[model samples]
Target: MPKSLWKIISRTFFFLLIPIILFAEVSGLSHSMMHKMELLVLQLGVIIFVAKGMSILFEKIKIPGVVGELTAGIIIGPYLLGGIPLPGFEHGFFGTYLALNPGATLPVSPELYGIATIASVLLLFMVGLETNFSLFLRLSATGVIVGIAGVIVSFLLGAWTGMLLLDLPFLHPETLFLGVISTATSVGITGRILTERRKMDTPEGVTILAAAVIDDVLGIVLLAVILGMIPVLNDSGQTVNWGYVLRLGAEAIGVWLLFTILGLVLSKRISNFLKIFKGINVPAIMAFGLALLLAGIFEKAGLAMIIGAYVMGLSLSKTDLNYVIQESLKSLYLFAVPVFFVVSGMMVDLSVFSSRTIIFLGLIYTLGAILAKILGCGIPLLFRKFNLLGALRVGFGMAPRAEVALIIAGIGLSTGLLSRDVFGMVIFMSMLTTVSTPPILDSLFKKEKMGTTEELLPAESVVTEFSLPTLETVEFVSAKSLQLFRDEGFFINQMEMGHKYYHIRKNDIFITMICKPNGIYFESSPDDTHYVKTLMYESFVELNEIINDLKDITKPESLKNDFMEGKDDKRVDLRRVLDPGCIRLNLRGSSKKEIIEELVDILDSQYQITDKKGVFEAVWEREQSFSTGMKNGLAIPHARTDNVGAITLAVGIHRKGVNFESLDGEPSRVFVLLLSPKHKTVPHIQILAHIAAVMSKEDAVRKILDCKTPQAVYQFLTESEG
Candidate 1:
């Protein structure tokens, strides 16, 4: 059978038979006596069409198609103008409408229920699969604390708002359930925003992601507890069964735990099994089967079908099969998910807004949601010294609600704790938050920059020095520093030198040198800084070895004898024997030009003078004329110059800061001078790369500013490397 022909036949069969079946049901045919298999076939077509149309609409609007699909359901159901409202069609096709409406009902049957269940489950599983646990773990402790605070605060606020707005008795069980639904934050929306903004790796992003995960788990538990109290609350404390509630809670937890463990184990096995498919379509089929089975299991366990679907997704997440599953399910999700959302939208009785009670409830709930996050996540950061802006940013980042909101609302409706109006309002809130995030975040980070050159050198008084005397010597340095030198290497020996410098004779060529005076300085260019930093760091290791040798030689006889006699209970403390120093250097010049000129002349007399602009241009031109003015008040003045004989560096600190066109639009206070040999085999660029990495860290920059002496600066740099 050709694919096109099969599709046509499928369509024809569905179109021709659906109306007949519906007419039969409406015309008083008994459900048990009637064979409505044709209606099932027709429904498949309808499901596919709605799914595809909703997906296309969502794509056009840049919203998830799931929203569209749900909207479609609402449109075709009793909630909207398009809903057919055939007597039996009000409920799901297989719902009680058929029995209740008899001859007036549509002929849709329950056979399609399995497919709907499967779709919902698989959608959730994919949510779990997409989550990155490691990224969640990396959020700073402050972020974690803030996230917890947000969840608690938001939940309480939501609960309180529910209590006040709900007209039901103060002690009504449904009110508490409504509160739980209101407090729910959808991880899906937050995840999408983080992904879109490329902030998933940042401190704020990771914290939000982790907090949302924990919040979901906690919310579900709370929902169960609330639901358990419903029967007693509704019956006015009559015939309450605490034991049953406890048993249900325990069972739910056990099932959840068992499922999680099973997912982890099955993920590994599934990954291995997928490998056998090689270039075949077996993986897709296997995934589909697995999705179905998981959904069925979750449904059996009395949890939402999506929970099982999400577990299945998590199981496949660690496997190569995940991408395969995702791709295969894309069409289904695009179609079914939108049906879900559109239906939700259709259910929105806008008339509810006219009710002052509903309006007050919505306002109160929204306020609670905002306040909960601010107080929960933001207040704790004040003690950590984060400014109000930073704390607010963190809180706002966690504010959006998404799919989880709908999930909770659905739970509310199913359990009869909330009316359709309340459920619709909750959905409205979720949509508002979800739609608002992208613009809010874009505005917040529009001026934010990353990986700027200014971040490489943050201090006003810093120096970096580099030396390349011979080819072998350069090779040694390059090997130790891992390609700190990127040009030619030559050996120099028996040359005159001064206290702070050395003169070198490479073959017949000679290079002059000068002693660096206490006030004068020489540092590696930004390019060479990494190499010099690495060499300085390696030198510390050698110093430690020398110290150990001295300690062995100077050991007291009694101590040595005690050790040999096996009477010593403690090991020698090497750290106690070493003396550490701190360094700070501050230099002031009339201008950046005077500073660079004076510092360069002091380093060496023979070194050629290069214009700052020319040097900047040279470095930029090499990498497509890029400026290394990484914002945040730092600039790395680097160039691969031919004027120097070796890979050299000169660091100049500007107390007044220099105009280096930093990305952050701030003055540059630190400069790294880079000199690469005209030709060399060593990768000198690696040194600069490493140094940039070190400087990028906020804490490291702070430590650098705290140094009080040259030796201290050296020690800080060396200790930081470790």
Candidate 2:
């Protein structure tokens, strides 16, 4: 232990000892009252200390902090701590003696259960606060399919396991709860591992997370139906009251239906209402209060508290208070969540080890947990054209079971649906799944090297837009081959010396281009399926465009009027626009905005335009919408507006490229800023094309870059073939 931690521990121990000594000396207090106070002190002092300490200890050993918290409760629990005699006290302070007394109900104070309940409620609320409801509707096809498959398979397997072991009837409460536990996985552990491996944003990792989220939603609905019907189990607990069970189930579903309606109807209202307390943290507090209210409503309506909490989160998911609630409620999550885990651990009686049946059932339950997730989640991925390796990775990623298991097992134990031995077995199954899944995932992923997909994205932030355009081969081989793709408006997310990657919006489809000395290579994501045909067609279209462009480059003189618009009788002369005074030689502006201002000034000063501000605003506004920077260090910033009397043009050169947020990753060295009256820039467009074509050539760009003054640049541009 650190010296600071040791000091704090020693002081905490001394202070707790003082409480006992002080309380014992008081003579007026009743025995039970004294015991209550003493126990409260023990819970506050010992429970919190041991829980936090053990969580730290367990975390160091690569086990989850929850495992350590639970182990701490077990060590100090009646099965271990209270099994031994203590000095002075009637029982050991570690636990209330219960198992030692036959036919005795649990002696644990109701206050402790109360705390655990609060922890559960808060934990669920935090989950709700963090969840993104819209994301469910936006999940890719593969994600949706995998999630449903995982749920269907796991739920069936779990129900089968329960029926096989217990001889339960169809739709039995015990059988259904087993299936519920298996269906809802805890993705946090696996998610963190993906983050460590830098694969969190990769196709496989992204699909697993999206699938997990989807299943959690589906699981909540399944669990609600099961819990609602549990009340209809008959006197013998074998047969169910069909009408009553159906009615109860309907009522549960109705509550959720009403919740959805209210959430949709009231989302904007909630956001507007939260704005009332804009300067204060009251919005977050009220958001939490709303979660509690929803939780209470769900509980009263026959669903679990967590279901209500999750619904409340979904309700506020579209609200602006989402991030505020998360940041503010983090302290509450940290303080209260570990208590629920530790208290749950304390509830696990080690006496289950004495029963061979419990051991056997626990092992079988674990087997069902692992195989169901693998077969269930993996098979769908493979069917959806995911590679075998990717299918296996996603399956294991969704396998760890912790949070949902504990919640369901607790519900079962509390409702008398499960016995102590069964509860212990369930908890063991939860721990087993969580502890064993990671190593298998690690081994599987380690053997096949992770792709460069993760490396292309920003590691620390959520990057929405690529900062620059894709870079291509010097021969423009990939550039020409990717022209049709570029026109389709895919985000050029990543680029290297000889490669580029493009992502289709709001979908899992990815395209990668690799340029080789011989030719170019093209491929799309999920290469195991027919999607490759789409990739091939796109590649074919771009190849044709590339061939046509090469043919045009060979016959450059034929392109002078190619990109022109409606013909004008008074078309402005291209050579006149390149006058010495109109060309800015080695312009010194540092940003796109600054360079634009300098170029616009040349046209304004030379032409004496009446509305310089209007012309600048029009040009700047167009640039702001999207970069006018063409590929290979050329930009044609043009605006057609009433602000300018005629089609006017100015050329500016920035040797040190101003990032116009250009498409090409290089600084734009050549600019063609055009300002025209409303409706016509036909001749101007033709001139802009000629400038772009000339800039595209190596010798032409070299001469422009080597220009000594504005006269030299003007001379070169005017003398050059249009």
Candidate 3:
């Protein structure tokens, strides 16, 4: 069968299954025991697809993907489209499970919730591993003041708002829960924005991060206290036992601090222990297994599992294994994180909003939440080195609450401390804060220096930077440096594969290397600067030696012939960028320069080239150094210059071959001209490589030479790969 026909039939079958699935749901077939697994599969598919689509739309509008994922869940949740009655599911496909009580907090099934819980644990674990332990300590003084102040103020405002708006007594469980939830902020969200703005190493950025870390710690402790209070407060009407609550909160803090300190202290030993399992995968998996075990222990100890997971990650954050574990678990993170966010959103029951009072409470509560963070976190900065603008930046930075807030609110709803109406209000507040933070933070920091000179401290780590002429040279140096490190008995860890980032350690000596597009950066101790420079000088000397050796044995004519005549197993589609109007069936030019001029004129006539004469000159300059003419009747003339706006192509054929100074001393019949903007030149090399590989086929060249019209030639090229 034809490929096109098969594609159409397959698409038709897929479209036809949609109605079948819907009919099955309507007929109650999906509710059967045998189809339960099928239902879960369908639910996952819809969740992932819709989540990605909504995330893309939100990202286009400059909002975070997390907010979009939440929006996706709300749209498809049981309270809205997911609640429409089907045959057996009177409340729709994703409706609340029958096993739960009427006023249950969760709308999805217990199994899905379980998955989301696991995802949350993993997400927290990843966050912990990525935390900068050294930087946290360096900025802890300011961070502590900002973080504590923010938490206290936010909690008071949130609790007070609940009491005033709901006519509840002070210290009510709902009020306390509200206060606890308000104290939490999303570290991931804040760090992402700072990193995007290139302010992560700045004074305000580091301070915000430090404060965020402390915020998480304090928030978790407060959550533990509230959880302890819930049972006692429920039994006694606002008559709480202060002694037991304080002790419980103290115990929680002690446990957290003890583990955190021990983990940081033994991080090196733990890293060495994990290194027993060779390769990145095993060690990474082993580290994650430890995280899971710790999480379970935390749960057993009557704390959130995420707390244990966070401790384990923080312990490993300072180790050499940190980046390796993060890189290995990336796929798992991508798969699970979205599930957690979407499920959190799914718990939002919009039915509560039918009450005008609930809507009013939500709006008013959201306003209070916003004000609480701004005042709470910002005020502490004024006492330090921050100006009003800096204080505002730090305050806005901490205002956006996300993952931790949801986790706390989930605890409230599950334990029956918070009603569904109040839960919806919490979700409303989280969404608004998260959605509004980025643009506001971005606008405030634009071209403004918010920190005093005395407070803005440089990082302690000594950095050695090198600027290179090209990306290829940087990559070459990086590879050579890795080998040199290995030769010197250093352990090498590739943190990010695509970016060519590496972390190498040998006993007391530790170094980090990163290869950017235009340069390489090295980070090490101050005492190791000389050692680093020595290694770099050695690399340059070795490179120079290699260049000198090549000069003695190189033959330009032989090399050109070998490159052009070489056949490749791979095929690339060149027809997509090749316009039909750019092809010439017959060439009137009989010389090399004339053929190039003819092709340039074709590009100009098609309006693909801006500066036609400049482009022609650029291509000729490249040709003068070495002939583009190959062994066969083929020639590829290309140039990257400012004359072209984008990658453009023009092809011409000469029935009567022209003298193009071919390597094999033969005439040229086929000419392919390529041009690209100098600023955007990466694709230029790729297309040139593709043309050299594809045109090596003698039979393909013969067929192209016989083509009578531009349309036939274009079609043949397009279908050649297929």
Scored by TM-score, the top model is 3
For model 2, residues 493-550, the per-residue Cα lDDT tens digits are: 3334323333222123344454544444544444422543454457567767867999
lDDT of 1 by residue, 539-632 (tens): 5466568669987877443442232222211232212221222111554665445545544553344334344454434455543444554444
Per-model CA lDDT versus the true structure: 0.54, 0.69, 0.81
Which is superior by TM-score, 2 or 3?
Answer: 3
RMSD of candidates 1 onward, in order? 24.9, 20.1, 5.1
Which residue runs of candidate 2 sit more than 4 Å off their true CA positions?
A: 1-38, 82-88, 97-107, 235-238, 241-247, 278-280, 445-722
For model 3, the local distance difference test gives 0.81
Model 1 misplaced stretches (Cα beyond 4 Å): 1-70, 84-114, 140-148, 169-171, 232-234, 237-251, 273-281, 298-302, 346-356, 380-390, 449-722
Which candidate ranks first by lDDT, i.e. highest?
3
Which pairs, if any, clash in model 3? none
lDDT of 3 by residue, 532-632 (tens): 89998898888889889987898788777566655542445566579999999788997788999999999999999888899999999888978899857
Between candidates 1 and 2, name the one with more favorable TM-score: 2
Provide the lowest-lDDT 10-residue window in model 2. Answer: 461-470
The order of the candidates by lDDT, greatest first, is 3, 2, 1
